[model samples]
Target: MKDGEGHISIYIELMDTSSLPTGWTVTALVNLFVFDQIRDKYYTVPAQYSFTTDYSLVRFSAVKLEWGITSFVELEVFNDSSNGYLVGDDCVFGADVFLIKQPINKVNVLWMKLYPKGNGKVAGNNISAYLCLDNLTLPSDTNIFVKFSIGVRNVVKSTIIKSTSTGKHHFDYLSPSVGRLHIYPNGNKMKDGEGHISIYIELMDTSSLPIGWTVTALVNLFVFDQIRGKYFTVPDYSAVRFSAVNLEWGITRFVELKVFNDSSNGYLVGDECVFGAEVFIIKQPINKVNVLSLSGEGANHLTRTHIWKIRSFSSLSLDFYESVKFTCGDFKWWIKLYPKGNGEGKGNSISAFLHLDECNLPSDTKVFVKFSIGVQNVVRSDIINSRAEHHFEDLSLGRGFRKLISLNKFEDLKNEILVDDVCIIQADVSIVGIVTTK
Candidate 1:
């Protein structure tokens, strides 16, 4: 440190740390030039700093200039969910500091609709469920996450068929058949509504539920983030940056920062700069805590089945070979994954082998890489009356991604979630010839 100089240069980068944006390299050196305007002198401060390594895999690091540490600013690190903690109000000594990160959590698929129960009175749909969340407790106002999932609560198998015809057919007038309607005389069945879903809720996630602690049901709501330009609010399970709710399962309404030009309750669009939203969930104080993964298989997991011709109930591994295939000029891939062992065992989350219909591929065309998984061959089983929704989402198709249509949503809205094994996907390879790129 030098104090006798008549000039000083301000710099925050150091050579030994790591390479950064710019000035993240080099050394401290400036040329001093002197000119005579009657004893006038000029000096140039060419400050240089260098890093000890690369910054490609780091968030940030800092070294304190030891000066009794009375007044100093330190580099802070936090989860990416913080996008920017939308710091507006504060009463702090670190109290205002919030950390965020990407979110991870499980969701149970459930479909519900408003329908009439007994007495012909309109009522809320009975939601069958077996849902739970890990790390549902909040450590501070900063960490929270919400997972979006539906549970098939109280669903009963249905028995109804419309002579779904195919194969050899007969035209009574000329022997030109129009498919067969071989229905099982005894296989037709249906079950009525079970009841409203009510999964057990416990405060402390442990080997056993705590004595009296309870996790009262909670939910969070959202309007829109004009700054982010997205209106949809997706619940995030983990604090990881990816989840829409920033994993704030805290069950609090989202809030962005802005100066009030009018009453807050009356704030309108284009009112303020949205740094980020905040979600919250407070927990009752407890001494020791242990976070456990859901006891059985992951949440919202679907049951699969096989056998194409049988309109079976929810069964495991329903064979869909006849419905899946490739078409000329089309580039797509499908994947399926099922528990390696018992349906309730825990193991690595890996995908099943991808099978392609090479015969239909327009010769020499390649398949685009994608992120997808499914139940290979699912048919209705005697146990589970219906199959779980096969989850798939498209990532810009040219790269081989298929668009995901929340099939679960459609089923609930259409009141068709209780049907037996149904094909959730139908890739029309015949239309490959018309796809165009922008």
Candidate 2:
């Protein structure tokens, strides 16, 4: 009940449950409480009762409530243990409630594949492919603006080919492009019946841009020369319109290109290579959109060491297995060790590997980590090391150096890899980057 003076009364009803099991009876003391949204806390109401019997109407009055703001309420009940009614393995019930409703936003993900439609050979530069988005669902009248790229996988590690605004370039390595290639979702310049992909880019509303300034996008493409390890610029650099109005309805466009072989220009790697690309908002006058980095970008590296004192290592009847668990870059990891070499190195060397504990990680996530598995010299200060960088996705959980150390060399006291009965292993882990995709 609300009065004209801005004060209202709230009521809660306790339904009668006399129809419960023949001998069942609820006998508990209950309390009432209210929540203050503005204060982020709960205030107990001055109401307590011994609910031996249920009633239809329980009313509360003189509650000071905000006129237009949101609020919450809660109800609590306690069992009076001293009373014989709530004993002998009886259960108590309570409830938690909220007043206002919040809105939710959903995200969509798109996957695509590329297929070569020409002669199935990239040699001599006649190779072309139809890169299409296989499955996508969008609301009617919705537009999408997107930037697409195609390049070799792990380019940073190989450095065989470089992609830039200017085009593809060959650095210190004379990247022999087995052939140059282009990616096209839908294009009239080249005929590819293989597949089709709906391409779109998403741009944030500029009306809310920092200080309300507008920005546009300039798009370009770079094709890769596989063998030569270089990139050739594809024609057609176009500027697209971007505005606050288009925030809801973006630009919808398609891409397709033709690749010409440039072996004469020293651009040919081989018949096969992996490629990737990035499409994003213009980053010139805007100074790039703000991003929060949880860990240092590039190479945020850390190391961990473990020593295993195996008094019986020399007398072991069979191969010995051991492992250690540690944390690096906010991720749980483990070191798997084998005293007797595994696989081809069995009985000849020691094997070690790094494994990721998938317990706390999200499904289908990508984790990039670089690390080294090494044996620490126990007698002298030396480390036998094996270093590698890898991309660990949902499917890849562990990687390692199989033949880390030779057993004969390990037993040699002069080598110092092992002293007395203790063996030392070290893992230097560097988390370069992490990406969570929806």
Candidate 3:
């Protein structure tokens, strides 16, 4: 049949309905098709419908035995020569019917949660809801399209407090996690003043966790130095506890904005910077105490200075050179220098490290020291130095700065760091404290 709007429809009509049983009804899956001349295929439209007698038509001595699509195809499309529906004034139309005694059923499951106290930035002021898909039950590469609605009812008012329908969303393996890093380039006013950047690691929906649950972890934040290819690490000396009341922990003044934005610093290059975090959860912390005794005030606390002079410094070609062992505190130490820098600072700066000789000390002993290492400019009496405090043990034998001094400044004739092919490096060591577990 053809409609007034120039659309043709197909219908299935049962003949001789008088032979059917009383109050008869049948359901069928139907497909209407048109022949494609060029492709030699059929363009089919499939649908399901139940056919029953129409009592109104029965009163007029007729039976309503027709049920099918009302808009199968437009007349213009069916007659178009390019569509291959009609070729040389000849076309074919047909239908296929699959009778079904019972309909098949399928079920899809999804998990959802509602937070009356809100979550994330909207916590304590608004309500939020989230839907989760069960990935464990599905194939690894499966993708799901979802549309859902969430509503909260006000029982006292007999009305909906809020109702919202989020249209369609695609879910995949790369979905966002509940923990995120919050960075404020201009600094967080509540935590820090201006001229600095603030960073925090936050657990988004802490209210969803089990009661009295707490997580203790050692967190370290880092800013990448693009030019040096290394990270400036800011480590937390102690473990931080995260709970429902306390959702985040971080540095209020991570880095001064001026220092981070400076091009020479290699931090904010090309208007981009990288920030990351390392969180090590302490699953079973040991219950132990450490007592430290420093040796820098009394007779035994005298500072020790070691000056190592290298002849033919310009002729040294090794990647690294180590000074002879020197006495510091109760342990022996040495100075390790990379003439052309090392690791991330290779070819750009001079790298120096203080190494502890752990062979003589007890296997479990840890030594804490504060030391300064420098290259002396003999002509101007100006020293380029780097100072740090570190704990040295069997596992951690060395620690120092990679970019100690730029090669340009270190080798400049005016700096006189290297004079007449001779260079001198000095180290000042002091025993800060020692950590020994009982």
Candidate 4:
């Protein structure tokens, strides 16, 4: 059969399992195959299982008598011409089963311990638990991938106290343990000691990492405003270094308690709030140092201007248009215009934006730019304009006004901003500084 993800499935079906003996059982190693015409060979997937009448194996039963591979081969690989699994619109599939004698039963048990009073770094503040495996029962080199769940039960009410599951993890000779720690008594710790909101990013299990490992990253934290439908973001302009000794970085007082709790602010609604973070890891070259050069702020600053002339402006029906790329401050930039405006200005005004070509900039590079976007008046010296300054990086590649000018004012006959169905857009860009890792 074919599965939903376009993969072939194979199953072993048993007939009349109720007529078998009480302890009847058969163990076998099975292999499913797909014939490759080009190679004149078979692609095989192997698995081992035991079909039994006994109740020990929970997965096998009289009612459920079939078991096998669900993903035998991908449809794409089976149908590709070059691979030749299918030729002349015909394909071959088969299975092989080898009977095996019953093997000795072995049981591996995992031990878990809970500290009701908490432990280690979380003492007195939270509860903790650890999972342990008896390495002496297995070979020294043996490794197992395991996933399990832990829960605290309420004995009096016969209900759940708290429960969490550990995602898959590898257990080996060196690192044979994995567990959870510092589960707060009440709930998640969204607030700091001062009653204000707090947030941070921490590297998990840093003790297991190799020595001398370090990571440098730029971090941005955000809180969602339910009323505004936008994020209130705080960003770190510079990168923060994280190592074994310093595993976390963030803001303790992300927002004042009074401000965030206010109903009008829309930060917390229905006793729920959303918080998120963006961390960009900066990779550095081994055995080399990075030097950042900054351009002077005042007299030594560099500036440039570009004018875009849009002919047949009324004929533009698209949502937005991009001007030809121009160079400034050793970087490429382009002007973006929305004929019918966008976002808040849609259908009522004209929108304009300046964007940096982030693809050409290094991952660790950031450019601080001050710029002005305007529409030139053909009949008068006055130009409708707006100015802003921003630090351009991967996350923020563009900045501009959503309502550059009201459509009524821009189209007024006396303004002459648009004459002969041609309009002019101008941008004055100045580079304040630049930071880059060499």
Candidate 5:
């Protein structure tokens, strides 16, 4: 710091604390100058300050003195200051220290737009924005986390609309390389009844930040102006800046201005408008987070057949028998044959049945299956067919006909029904529907 009779000089320097926690960096943007009390003028340095290292230095010399005899020197440091510091009659020196460096974790503004929702029977409308980041490295062996909210404010109104709503839509990113987020303001409060609105996006978070660095984020917002037929930003409010340590940052409050939807307001073009946003993330640290991989197999269709040739037809061991088992539609089934026939057709006809694997179908659930079973006449090339179609719940599991074919017809040698003292049988199975009862 230097002072003289008719002028003043200010010198600024930075020092890096190597002991600072991870993700934390040290730097400052300093504007050193002499405010003229009498001339009402500011004599500032010729160029902006740039601090890239711990030993960086900036000097402002010979700034013409203010108030003639009594003057004061002002120093200001900030990450962003697009809005002039002169508010009303007071001089404001605002500072935003971005301490975090993101080399791997990249944050960006994906998209923003205004959508209209009708009133009355229709729902209210709103304006929404999306935020995304790629390659976010979460610390391993520790549950390190961060939380923040996005916000929107109308340039035409004087109220700040925080984008943090419980109903705000959020998506869990399954990809290991990227994270996506979105938020929308209540439409009813945003759009003019005629369908025109102006809004901007902001970020806010009070969650813990990584060690060693301060985090600073810059987001740019724009609105389509109907009168000018181009995108325009409200002066001094086009960019939102956030500066914080892990878990120590807060949202910057904003005021809204009311712009009517009518032509006189000059914001809407036939009840439509467009909006957009962009974000800048800065940070430094080497860490990693896990990304999950998901996959599944598709459904399949299959068909199978089983055959049983019965020998010694005159000396059968039992009245009824079943063929070898086959599988289809994830279940086991078989064709059953009763050479002597059953029920009303006893000793006169051959019976055939289709049986389902009892253990495969859950007893607590209802299952529907369709199948056909039959015995083939070897020489005649004709089929003794039996069809079964029913709901096989916990009760019934099998379907068949007592008299699938007459004994005389099955035994006839001219038709070759009993060829070479051997009989052949086959069956077809398919699952059509399955439902679990409550």
Candidate 6:
């Protein structure tokens, strides 16, 4: 009620039943001095947009929804976590934090298969990644590395991306999480498609060159080899312009960053965002990228010791081995023991089946084991039994030592239980089967 300004407020204490309107209507009833007779609650809501809130909110307008400014939205998003997430689809831990910086969430659909069209668009045949909701943006002239996780088959070159836009700033980053960008929405060169991701990056800002700039990012469908072979170079790229821009480090203001899947197979995009280029405030330049180490390295055996003790079973150590430190080529290392359940370690007592596990091992690989051999049980004092056990490699289908001489007995003899005997059989790899002798 202000001085005669028709701007008076109406107070309607409508208890909102916090539920989305599926098929609900609003009925309003009020009485006034102008009305002659007492009126019933009049309900007039034909087609209203449904909205529900989980907090205090006041309606400033009944129809056009003038929700009194509060730190809350009158809506709830029940997202199916299975079918990936869209842009702006976030999980806020503290209720309200989107005011400072743009909050981000990532959803990935790995190993998506697709067939590319030779005409230029990357076919969404096995379209693994989709930004459903309001389409996500892939910046223009953005020199980013977008990698797909494809396997030893499937042509990423013939692939293209098809998506609706959010009207503005709709760019795509296939494998780019780092560097320089020049391609814009209207540019038409770096639009989201298949065969290869094409974009440009900014190298020179103002008059100074980017001294600390280098492109580095982990991409999907791209292995170390594929990256080495393709994408790293955009043909004849010199400046950020129409078709393909040349990308060398400091020569041009804009450079094109390209990525192509050498082995058209399925690959999972790892969720670690690397920079298009890491800029350092340096006077001159720094170092080149780090050199690669051991290629396709198998396991480097750590504690290669055999089990030789009370025979019934020796508890395997679980503390020392949390994860497998060595690689097992084609076969897995399954360190077994006797008495079925004696490997059960308890506290410090050797009783638990302590082990490290690996799931992504290659097929047809096996592990050889060695034992801790000490003097006491056998005819030779310098040696316990046999360094004497025999073993051979086999091309069998299953894992473990192809040809091995396992102790084959939980207790070889009654007195063989070594209450007084002191011995330790040392071997190379952890034997799959526990070998014991009297």
In the range 85-130, model 3's lDDT, one tens digit per residue, is 8754556687765443322222245677667897768679978776
Residue-wise C-alpha lDDT for candidate 5, range 1-438, written one tens digit per residue: 234434323333334445556554333223355433224345454321111111111221233112111122323321112223332132422222223222333333233322345222223655443333222443322121233445666788966666432112221121111122222222223333122232333233223344453433333344446676664543321212233422211112111334534455454457544444433443324444332221223223434456677777767869788777777766677777787887767889877777777887754565556667777777678666777655565555666777877878765642475667677776766565565643
lDDT of 6 by residue, 1-438 (tens): 223233212223334545636544342212111110112122111111111111121222234332222211112211332222211132221111111111133433222323343111323433323211111343333322123222333367765333211111111232222123322322233334333332333322111224433322111111122223322222221211111232312222122223222233211124221112222111112333322222222334333443444332244433322223333333343333222222222122221122223353323222233333222334333333323121213322222221122233313531343444432333334333221211
Model 1 reaches what TM-score against the true structure? Answer: 0.16
What TM-score would every model get versus the actual structure? 0.16, 0.34, 0.35, 0.36, 0.31, 0.20
Model 4 misplaced regions, further than 4 Å: 1-301, 413-415
lDDT, candidate 5, equals: 0.44
User: After aligning candidate 6 to the native by TM-score, how far in Å is the CA of 28 from where it should be?
Assistant: 46
For candidate 6, give the lDDT of residue 125.
39
- What Cα-based lDDT does every candidate model obtain? 0.25, 0.43, 0.66, 0.65, 0.44, 0.26
Clashes of 3: 0
**Candidate achieving higher lDDT, 3 or 5:** 3
Ranking by lDDT: 3, 4, 5, 2, 6, 1
**What is the C-alpha local distance difference test score of candidate 6?**
0.26
Positional deviation of residue 368's Cα in model 5 after best superposition, in angstroms:
1.7
Query: For candidate 1, which ten residues in a row score worst on lDDT?
Result: 169-178
CA error at residue 45 for candidate 2, angstroms: 72
Off by over 4 Å in 5: 1-302, 413-415
lDDT of 2 by residue, 116-218 (tens): 4433334345333222321234332222333343444675687433222122211100111111233434432233323332122323212224544544333
Model 2 quality (TM-score): 0.34
- Could you tell me which residue pairs clash in candidate 3? none
